[model samples]
Target: MGRKAIYTRVYNQLRYEILSGEIAIGSPLPPERKLAEQLGVSRNTIVRAYSELEAEGFIVSRMGSGRYVEALHPAPSHAQTHWGKQASGKLAAAPSHMAELLSVTDTYPNTINFAHGDGGKHTLESSCFSDYVKSTAEQLHSYYFTSVQGLPELRERLVAWMDMEPISSPEQVVITSGSQEGLYLITSLLARPGDLVVTEMPTYFGSLQLFQSLGVQIIPVPMDANGMRIDVLEGILARYRPRFLYTVPTYHNPTGWTMSLDRRKKLLALSERYQLPIVEDDAYRHLHLDAEPPPSLKSMDRTGNVIYLNTFSKLLFPGLRVGWVAANRSFARLLTRMKELSITTNTLGQLALAAYLRDDALRPHLQEVRKQYAEQAAIMAGHLDRFRPLGIRYERPAGGFYFWVSLPEEINPRQLMTECLQQGVSFTCGDMFLLREAEQPYIRLCFTHERTDQIDRGMKIIDHVLQSRKELLS
Candidate 1:
């Protein structure tokens, strides 16, 4: 073959190896002379191939060492070839934008973090948690691995805990790392490429990522103050016959709009009629500020229609990484096996959390959390009320960490996010929750993550920056 043909063959082979995950990321390629000898090609041909690969961004040449795969993509533009892109059409375009908000927090140590959904400064007391750790450690004599379904005691405790939510027995529960894992496991079992999954328009971003990763087609159902629009959902249900309905019925993440009793019943009724199961992610159920929200769909479900997902991450600490999925006995067993095949649940944390729950500490702690977040939410609302004329629209969240605020159409959310970060405050842009093409004149700010003092300062900064932008647009 000609020298050009030899180099082209070499380049194609190397590119295929890198993209197909055969060579592996960060692993060094053989020396040019060694590779030339191995491939039965001239060293110059191998050098030409390496140079092209480096230029294309498929590999990088280190000064002292050999060439290594920098990324699987040929270029930043070629990154659209991610497994998610091939499997699912719509990708969460917000991670890049959201990273900017996260970066501000990392870069500016004192930057009030309004973007993250985490327990604030006054999180669980160290002494209280230490006590549980001490007690749980004492009880756990062996350091060996436990069941993938999680610690028996933890599952039993969860069963009792779930009784209030009216979820089924311990037999129906399969413990997972977090509700995130539960979502993944269930999605793996049910959804496949080209399958349809329905969700609220401004649903949890994590759920969207999971669905997109599986190559499932996501059909968003619009929501109002009563939560997901059942009227709109009925039309989609009649036409599409989705795989499952994913929703956060109580104190939703971004909007904090709880599904009303009427809507909840209708949603369940539709699920029953269509034989569609519901994945009820009740992550923020305990964070209600004012009054109790409506009963969860799981609680109301008469048939084995709702797969209930609950997590300790929101109310409790995130590091614990304990969550559970409650379904019918048959599905519960399947989930338990799925957990076994994939990864085991956190044993130490589960034991510790079980010990903590045994004392019924969560209720009292939840009361404190409710009071603190309520105060913080009210403080933020008061400040935001002053800036209402700037076209900042929101329904004051009765509970949960976030206030989903809608900006004026003229004001670009990305521009506002950039200016806010510059002024020592940060929030997630609306585009983070939806596709880039979707018109998202919105932003989500977390009140629970910041202290009362920080909320005031942060809101003032946001107010000043946004008011200036509004005036410019005017």
Candidate 2:
């Protein structure tokens, strides 16, 4: 077996032995060399597995003696039927990696975090926001539910702010809880269970989870440096008809590669020819570091086939939970009607965000994030220079929060992440963004959520882990 396979197998077997009471509590485990020889693996592999067990509190090492198993008081087993057999298929379709994703972004107790998907988390919090939120709520003397279509004033403000002429208007907008809700609404409207939809291979994992939960089968189209390969898309289109095509396009999530203008235009031409509906998720459009990207796919469409979704989360903050969909008035109206299935959108958030935009806060905020995030990205790039010699590959993004790196074949991605976590750094593995797991390792590091100081610490720990793993393989 390979190192990863052998290590995992040995670790799991030892754990099972302990849990099954075969390896009694407080008993001394076999020495490293003995275990390695018995398992037909290298001593380093045995050491790695034992180190994990020690870190997880399954065993402990004595001063000069050897490792011994610790007492693990098992929880009392309850006699009741398991829930899986009775659960719906959609619930079963929900993937397990989401729990891992949450550990990095939400639950993990890490010293430095680079796995958070959202940016502006640190920069956007303030007493000023608190005051604005309070004032907005105070101005609403009576408790009235926001419309299903969202607060009218917010919709009007969004139309003016977007500045997409001719095609966009207040009536063409449907306010949503977040861009995520917009994705759900679009999927519900256009696609059904067992339906196929086209997406970039390494697209946003969040979207992949949602689609799978809704019983949608994804047909992933591979991407290149310039973004999704149009030629492959054409072949897919010729073979099977997907309900819609979803893309991040500008400063795409996970990969951070923007679609070239030429490809964007070609994609539009193909969309018109195939009559394909495209979902333009413009979450990071305003977060560029250098030059501005080309116009959004929605702005170029005259056929009204593109459903454009935008969020204030990336620009302002995620907790604000305000986003919108811009489509033709007819489609927008349908979305608004469908939204009645859920409760009215958060009115306080809508009113507060509209007021913030009314004060013209967006322009200055954009400029500020552009500068702050650019510096953060540069700091990470400088630190990542150490890995280039180790066959790590990445291109610093022009904009967006993540750095997508393809790691050397010598390293095991899951093992690397676990060891790095033990050293107090966290980042998302690349397989999380795909429809399936990957053989060669890839990872997405988000820089905008952490400051320059934390970036230095996180990258240094990652560098150390990479070097150690490389040596072990050697």
Candidate 3:
């Protein structure tokens, strides 16, 4: 073979090994001279390959310790494909903290798991839901499968409920098992491997997992109290040209920060400027305890650039697993074909939910749920106010079910979680939210699941744990 062909072969093999996790992150690669000798190539060829890898941020060279693999890149926040399991190569293992959170199984033994984002089961109490289920069961015998894009009635009702502009037609909506599935389908249809995607730093863990799985390169844009820092986003778009922008604009998860009207306008403008699509996840928008929910990003989208996704899980029941997407008619047709090949989301569930939404009972039940969540949020805030330790800070969420608390820098949240679990109070460690291997001294506590007394008691236990570990903080 020619010298160039020989060099190319050696380079491709090494690249494959690095990406497949054969070399592993932070591990020293074989010496360049040794690698060349093994591959029957010149040392110059190996050197050229290593240099290329370093420039691409796949690996780094240390002055004396030799070359080691760099950390894996962050995935997009909106799409499930970006967040799916990594497929070999020099990819770092899923962050240890996220793995620990997912593996936590002692739900009833000792730990009071406030870590999960789900509202307490009490929110499921409603006679209307039972009524709807019965109505759906009666129709099941006569039910033929609905159109691939889902029941036209449900799509029409969803758009009206959100107060979104007229969708052109029912063909523009695709029902899926949940909003997560909708996100996965959208990304699969829109993005290719190596596409750049933008998302908020410390965004939803599931979204991060999906994007990582798809091998999409993620650019983390920092979010502030108002929402995503539009200034930073503009700079990123001009420089990186991401394929899409993913956001949870109203009552954002984890942080519970909503974007302002002005910022929302700027976001849409930025998308138009860059010709990038926006994937808006509005899962928690309907769970507002406050009087007026902010107008959604979808409501504001005018140029057909935004794809909106929402679920009935938080507002009604998660077990139903019913969610839908509002997109351009052409894209929706493509996604429906994808959904048909996958499982047609439970017909019974969709029919039941359609009945529930169509009835007058849903509004009154929602009022009751809103009252309950408001009370729970108040109870949590009151407890935190009375017993919170020095140096701890938290945002008072206006609508959603979570309280995002930031702790002292000296404390390790992972260790604190262990200590709290020992005390029979459980919450998520903040490190799980991060894309990189950095430590964050924060925890997400879900107030909607527990009674007021339970919230008070849990706070007391957490306070004691922190007091006992105060020495560790220093």
lDDT of 1 by residue, 119-206 (tens): 7657666227667777767765425577777778878888888774445467788888888899999998987766878888677777
RMSD of 1: 15.2
TM-score of each: 0.78, 0.81, 0.79
Task: Indicate which candidate wins on lDDT.
Answer: 2
TM-score between candidate 2 and the true structure? 0.81
Worst ten-residue run, lDDT, model 1? 70-79
**Model 2: residues with Cα > 4 Å off, grouped in runs:** 1-87, 96-99, 105-107, 126-128, 141-143
Q: For model 3, where is the 10-residue window of minimal lDDT?
A: 85-94
Where does candidate 1 clash, by residue pair? Answer: none
Better of 1 and 2 by lDDT: 2
Shift of residue 411 alpha carbon in model 2, Å: 0.6
Residue 174, candidate 1: C-alpha displacement in angstroms? 1.2
lDDT of each: 0.78, 0.80, 0.74
Candidate 3 lDDT, tens digit per residue, 90-137?
232344454566455444455666876766667776435867787678
